[model samples]
Target: MLPEEGVNAVRVVVGLLVRGEYEELETLTEARRLTAAEIAAAVARHGRDLISPPDAAFREVDAVAVPHEPADEHAFHVEFPLWTAQDGLSDLTLGLTVTEVMDGVWTVELDGVHTA
Candidate 1:
């Protein structure tokens, strides 16, 4: 998949997570690999580390693509420098793996969330 497409997919996934839209988020993930409940639990466990509100809007500040073997799988490390009215540029990043399942179709897997 193209880097731009991967970035766009990451943005959508992050947006859903921020907005607490886990059900929709599940649809974008790898088939049967992730569930809405799992996503909610992950957020509940680690959300405090984030500087942005649950409903805060975000943008992709930077992204790096890592090529994988077999030529169909790629990993993207994306940073969204989240901020708030009180704090500027909080360090939160997301790791996502994008796999091409078919000719032009892809699936995403949330590797993890990180803070710095």
Candidate 2:
């Protein structure tokens, strides 16, 4: 799997979570190639509503313009040219627990740990 593919998979997971489609998350996990970390990062970065307390946990990582490198047939890394958003994500230092991950699905548990 390519890095771009991984990024797309992250997007799917965010959509599923935002839409509250837990079943799609299950199906996406089987079809997409991504890591739980990537999905969690994506949700933290893109899923604005998912960004919870402490507020400083969210971060707009330099945009992922470059493709990701697949660790294997099932995993990949997020690469980028470092995008800067005008509104940039807030709380730029929170990490999430990967409760689940898949092509179009993802679930993360934010325990309020400050990555800063």
Candidate 3:
């Protein structure tokens, strides 16, 4: 798959999580800081359903961009730029995880996040 496709897959995963956790994210303020480390911890405590691949682990990363190599296949890498109005948050990159659970059925998970 093209790198663009991979990025899209990642975006889908992120969208689901955000939509699912919109209420909590919206309540975030400077007083209510939601650091990447904190979020990563939450993913560990409350399953984020972020990823599941052959040998993939359950962990979260703080990132703003999940870089994808230009020459990649089977493992598609795509990027989705996120913008936020909340203070101290300008962007969030959700790493996309695509898996072939069944024939033609694909699963997605936001496994990586860019903080830098």
Candidate 4:
């Protein structure tokens, strides 16, 4: 399971994506792993339509631990079920990776909007 901090970070990043706040989203992400342009393109290509609905909401589903080579680092693939009033449950899921930068601090990496 991802820590509460990680989950909260994911929530903020997803909110930014839904709002088309790419510049703000880029600031919360790791530039070494995901570039600004890639972030913008992925959100534009995959997240734009799915998250455009004003009533869309993301509910936490589950998180899977992702192995990392560094002993001090940790990662998890977190998933959230997307829902909107007009469409009910969406086919697309909001997913992202959260990495522990140091101790309890984590950074969000956008996986974009994808079907689970």
Candidate 5:
């Protein structure tokens, strides 16, 4: 099972893709290992009429916002922009941070922690 925080982030990204918002889905440096952009693109590309442009159609994401999670192991978190010209969906700015809380663990252990 995936960590709830990671799962929630994946869900939100997948939800955004399902809604046809595949523009400017940049991957943060920290999350390079997760291949978030590739995953998002794959999820976004799953449907017909969903075009993966040669280049991102939206503005460049300045940063990624990572939601709070446990204080152990490693994790990837995202930040969405405040507002965007794209309708229906929220602005897609912000940043993503991949953290390594502890060494040697392949994934974070969020069993005992609460996410906010």
Candidate 6:
């Protein structure tokens, strides 16, 4: 099990993703090229249309805590169940890595994403 602080970090970052909090997301990412606003716009623009339907908004997200990831022992898996724009089922796992930037402050970064 992840420590309470680490779990909180993961939840906070994922919550930002769900809420489309671009400005805050910017600070959380390690991407050197794209800004958080750019990422947010992209997610909003293609979210449901490309992922769900012609114009279906990203209504909601359901996440499940999975076991520790084999690829990265330092990271953890959070599975998100979603339906495609074609109405087909697709699942995604967010491999998140949280680093202790300072005393009580932890920085969570998007390590990678697995889609199935």
Ranking the candidates on TM-score from highest down gives: 4, 1, 6, 3, 2, 5
* lDDT per residue (tens digit) for residues 1-116 in model 6: 44556656766665666565757776766653346766655555545422321222112223233444443334333344434454455454445556544456655656443454
Model 6, which residues run further than 4 Å from truth?
30-34, 41-46, 49-90, 112-114
lDDT of 3 by residue, 5-116 (tens): 4333444445544554533332421213344455556444533344322111122222233243332314333344333334223344444445433444444434445532
lDDT of 4 at 45: 58
Q: Which 10-residue window of candidate 5 scores lowest in summed lDDT?
A: 107-116
lDDT of 5: 0.36
Best by lDDT: 4
**TM-score of each candidate structure, all chains considered together:** 0.61, 0.33, 0.37, 0.71, 0.29, 0.50
Model 6 clash count equals: 2
In candidate 6, how many Å is residue 4 off? 1.1
Cα lDDT for residue 55, candidate 3: 16
At residue 71, candidate 6 shows an lDDT of 36
Model 4 TM-score is: 0.71
> What lDDT would candidate 3 get against the real structure?
0.39
Clash pairs of candidate 1? none
Highest TM-score against the true fold, candidate: 4
In model 6, what lDDT does residue 4 have?
Answer: 57
Candidate 5 C-alpha error for residue 16, in Å: 1.5
Alpha-carbon runs more than 4 Å astray in model 4: 32-59, 84-86
In TM-score terms, candidate 2 sits at 0.33
What candidate 3 gets wrong by more than 4 Å, as runs, is: 1-11, 22-73, 87-89, 100-103
Clashes by residue pair, model 4: none
Models, CA RMSD each: 4.6, 10.5, 13.0, 3.6, 12.1, 7.9
